[model samples]
Structures are given as C-alpha cells and as structure tokens.
Target: MAIESYRLNVAEVIEETADAKSIVFDVPADLQAIFAYTPGQFLTVAVPSDQTGLAARCYSLSSSPHSGRHQITVKRTVDGYASNWICDNLKPGDRLRVLPPGGIFTPKDLNVDLLLFGGGSGITPVISIARTALEKGSGKVVLFYANRDETSVIFARELTELAGEHPSRFTVVHWLESVQGLPSLEGLSLFASYFGGYTSFVCGPAPFMKAVTTALKELGVPRELRHQEKFVSLGGNPFGDVEEVLAAQATLAEADDADEPDETEQPAAPAFAGPVAIEVELDGSHYSFDDWTGDKVLLEFLESKGVDAPFSCREGNCSSCACIVLEGEVSMKHNDVLDAEDLADGIRLTCQALPLSDKIRISYNG
Candidate 1:
C-alpha cells in the first residue's frame, strides 16, 4: 500500500542562523493526530526536483511535541539539493508534501535523566528531546552541543531560555570548534564520564559521532543506554505509489545480489516454503495472521492487513520500521543502519524482512 502523504501549509519560517531555518507547518485539525510525533522523530518531505520530479528527504523535528507545533530545522549543506531548496524556496503560505512522523530515536521514558550530545545540525533533534523532557517529565537534561562557532549555533537563544527556566534540571554546555579544536576522544570520554549513569543520545557529523560512540563504548556504557542517530540519504523515492516503489526496490535488490559476492562463511538458511503464521504487537494492540504466504515484506503485509506499522525510508537505511523478533526469525534483504549488536538483540527492519520460519512473532513496543 502507498504510504499516505499530506500537504501542509508553511505557517511560519524562522531564520535560525546564517545557514539554518526552521519551517513550521500548519497541520489541519483532522490530521493532527496523524502528525503528532514524539521528540527525536522526523518527517519526510517531498521536495520538488526537476530531474526526478520529487526528492524525498527526512528532517528531524526541532519542536517539542507538547508545544503543539510541527517544526523541522534545515541547515544548508555545501552541495545538498534538498536542504538548499528548502532553505531558499520555502515561505509562509506555501504548501509542501510531507510524510507523517516516524523514527525510533525517541526515549521510552521521559523521566530518565538524559545526557545528549549534538553537533551542527544534529542539535535539532537533541533540543526537541531536551525541551520535551523538561516540560513534561521530572528529570535532568544535559546537552553538550557543538558548533563551528558561536554564530553557527542554532537554537542558541532558545536553549539559553530553557536553561534559565529550568536551571535546576537543565544545563547546556556549548563547544565551539573555532575556540577549542575538534573534540578529542579523550575529552569526550572525560566529559561523558561525569554523566555515566544518565541515558546517552548522540547525533552529529560522522567523525563526531564516531568519537562519541567510541568514547561511550570505552566508558563501558551499556549498549541499551547509548543511542546514536545516523543521517543517510534515501536511495529511492518513497513518495511514489507503493506498488511502483516496491517493484523498483525488488529490481534494485536483484541487481545488488547479482553483483555482490557471498561473504558469509556458513551457508544461509533456507527460506520457509509453506504459508506462515505471523503475530505482531504494535501500539499496544496485538494482531495475528495464519496465512502469510511470504510473498511480500513484513511492512507490506502489515499495511495490507490495516496495521499502521511505522516506516520512513523503506530501503532499510533507517530504523523507523524496526521491530523485535520475539519467537521466530526473519531474514533481511538489505540493512544499512543496524549493527551486529542490534541484530543480536533481534531488532529487524520490517521493510526488508522476509520470514525464515513457519511461525513468527514480533513486537514494535520497543
């Protein structure tokens, strides 16, 4: 089934920094529930493109869910097409096609003390998480935000205001690379050591994220307590008709399989041949099906059954469609985001999952 997209009016635009802008969408009341998102989730926008008709890009929401606003901050990248287009062309009264909120980068419990690290535009989601936690929960929030310089900091004023409002529970530590060279692994580890017990979330440039994650690992932070968001470009247009998207994806997968060498030492398990029985738990509801013929991916099958499973980039490059296998195994056609630890934890992307067992059970509660 084709994922639904909505046209939202650009309610306002705020110039955050020299190269960053925040676009607030005016979601109609009828669609408000569909657009309601948790902090750290993102919206996929269908940007107009002459070469491809439309370019789909995901932008993290910078507005707290409790603020009754749908806002996404976009920072101009050196040669980024979508970011540049959004920063230059979007204005009040303009309508843009956008997908509903989707992502797994949110905190399960708002009351848990959080230690957040953000770099450059990655501060967008971190601020949202911070704001929501401060306004709705009773926990401390510490943000270590890094920027090129003071002038390049997005949400500098807002963060200051939040700190002022919740001085006892919120703190902001700004790191300017111009003043103090790029953060070293030793420095990061030392700083993170102070908040050893807090749940840690990191989002930043590749190098920055690498340093922070490595530091966290060396600090012996449990895998469950450390989270990182990776920014990756979608390889396919998810705004297109669902059938067409799936067909194109299948062709691409076939080509990839043909060109890649088998790297696994052991032989792969054979796919289950008979009709399978599947069970899924999502959004506090349980669903079961007895005749899953294994003809389509799990997300496609769930949508066909009227289950509103979450998904963003169906290309397995994002964790929006992630679900945990509880009782049976499923094979992924492709995966770019999940690490070995995640797979060991049974986290599979529903968008690329195919049944490998006659009876399967999964849950999206996590």
Candidate 2:
C-alpha cells in the first residue's frame, strides 16, 4: 500500500534542554506495520488552530529508527506557533497529524569520516546520524555543537559520554556563544580546515549555516564534501523589527529594478475570472472547491473546505504547503520555497498559488 499521512498520538514529552523539548509519538498499528525512515528525514506536524495562528511546521527526527520510536526535538522559537504550541499545550495522549519522514539529509553510505556541525536546536539530525554511525562502527565522527551557553545545549551529557567512550573514533566540541574569551581554533581542528579526510555535514539556523559554509569555502573545501541542512521557515527574524524588513525589501526592490527584463515578457492580461474548479489530492482522496472571485489562492480554498492541510507561514515562505501540480498549471502570486528547478518541475506552494486554468490538480502527498 502507498504511504500516506497519519495522525500520531503524543505519548510522552521530555524536556531535552532549557528551551527545547522532545516529543515521542505513539505510532498507529497500520503505520507502524509498514513505516520505515532514514536517519535525517523530517516529518511535518499539523497542530490544529482556530484559523488565527500560524499553521503546521516541519521538525526533523531527533531519534533514529534504532530507538524504536519516532521523536522530534523542538526549540521554543520566539513567536513560533507550532513550536510554542507544542511546548505549552501539547501533552501526552494528544493527537497530531504527522506527515511521513521526507528529505535527502540522511547519510547515503557509512564508509567515510563524518564531520558534523550543529547550532542550538539544529543538533537533532546531526546527533541521530552520529549515534547511528557510531553504533554501526561505520566511520570516524567529529561533532561541533554550539549554543548560547552550556545550559542551553541539548543532549550535552549524552554526547559527552559518547565522545568519551569512543575517544579515538569520536570527538565532540562545545562552544558557548555567551562566553567571552572563548578558545580560538589556532591548534584545534576547526571545520574551516576541512580536516584532510572528512565528509562535512552542517545544520543550523540560516545565518549560522551561511557563516560556516563561507568559512568552509574559504578553506578550499569541495562542494560535494560539504553537506548542509537548513530549515526553510525560521521561527523568528533574528535581525528584528519591521523597519529592518522594509529596509531590506527596499534594497531588494532597488536591485530588481536595476535588472533588465527579458524581451520575451508576456503582455499583461485583464482581470482573471473565478468560480473555477480547484482540485487537490491529499492522502489519496480528491478534494474540489469552487474558486469564487474572493478565493484567489489554493490554501484559502483548502482551508475554506476544512481540508486540514499542513501549512506554515501562509505568506509562502515555508514549504510546509509545497505540492506538485500533477495535472494543471497554476501561477504563483508569491512563493519562497521552490527554486527555479522546482518551479520547472511543477512544484509550487499552495499558499501563494492561484489557478490560471479552470481545472487544477495538486498533490501534497508528493
């Protein structure tokens, strides 16, 4: 049978760090009977909302399949809907609709040296891979975990013990962002060095990954040797304030205005008609909604029909509502998730998508 999204009951909640929590889910019998996943994939969790709060968010699995339970670690991001809600309201026995694990972050082979870097809550999948690699004795591993302070570090003791037990095969380094006079990497093997023989993996918030990748590039690390995982939709803007956002947007606008448009631009059309049939497939079922004049987006249509579709940041910044257009063409009013290749391949974010054709079919299961 084809796999589809299923609702898992929250069985236990464990506080992993100061502001982070790990939630274990009770897998249903049918799902458990056939469920299989790699180490670094993620599951999209849908938290029911009153149509006001932000929608569902995706969290990577912190625990590997070896643990025999599905678990996700969430950091309480400032103004994060799913993260904050899971921390505050979600308790044992609560049910959450969870999409199956999906992504390409998992290690493809285990015969090479692994260099892992994580910051704050981004340690989830890094730890999972390290643990599994060590257990299998697949390769040598080094982990660099950075956080605000020692107390904010999640899985500190466990990671320390793992490194201690496998001194020659494993190494763990901790960096406290709040600590001044921290040790410099003059003598130590910093990730920037590429360390001679290592397949580097990095996961963190966007800025952290960018800095690390920049350093890695400066160190002459080959692109294939470096692997980075970034959560697309950040919970909060670390830069802060609407003024900064507007300023940045102005800069982008200036840049775009300076660019020359292609001569192949299509002529602008008049107003679009509606009451079109927008068909979508979720979990093998087809849902059709009448697209009225006011209904301009696929997400709005889905929500209006009470489809319980997974989403986050209805502004189209997150791929939580990403789907493939299996049959018809749709125009994006706005989208930040898909790259050029994805758009060429017909993947679109339903949040910012509008049907150009009267008939459309989008599948979130893809």
Candidate 1 ranges beyond 4 A from true positions = 242-270
Q: Measured by TM-score, how close is model 2 to the native structure?
A: 0.64
Q: How many clashes would you count in candidate 1?
A: 0
> How does each model score on lDDT?
0.90, 0.71
Alpha-carbon runs more than 4 Å astray in model 2 = 1-3, 52-54, 180-191, 234-366
lDDT of 2 by residue, 1-366 (tens): 112457688999999876899999988667875446677767767665554222456788888888788989999989877788888888899988776765556777766888888988889989988887887656899887888887899999889889888888999878788873332343123644746657788888776766776666666777557776667654322122332535666577769877777442333232146657667788778887766332456776777778877554555555656888987677776655455646876888776676667667788765
Clashing pairs for predicted structure model 2, backbone only: 275-291
lDDT of candidate 2 at residue 337, scale 0 to 100: 49
How high is each candidate's TM-score? 0.91, 0.64
Residue 294 CA error for candidate 1 (Å)?
2.9
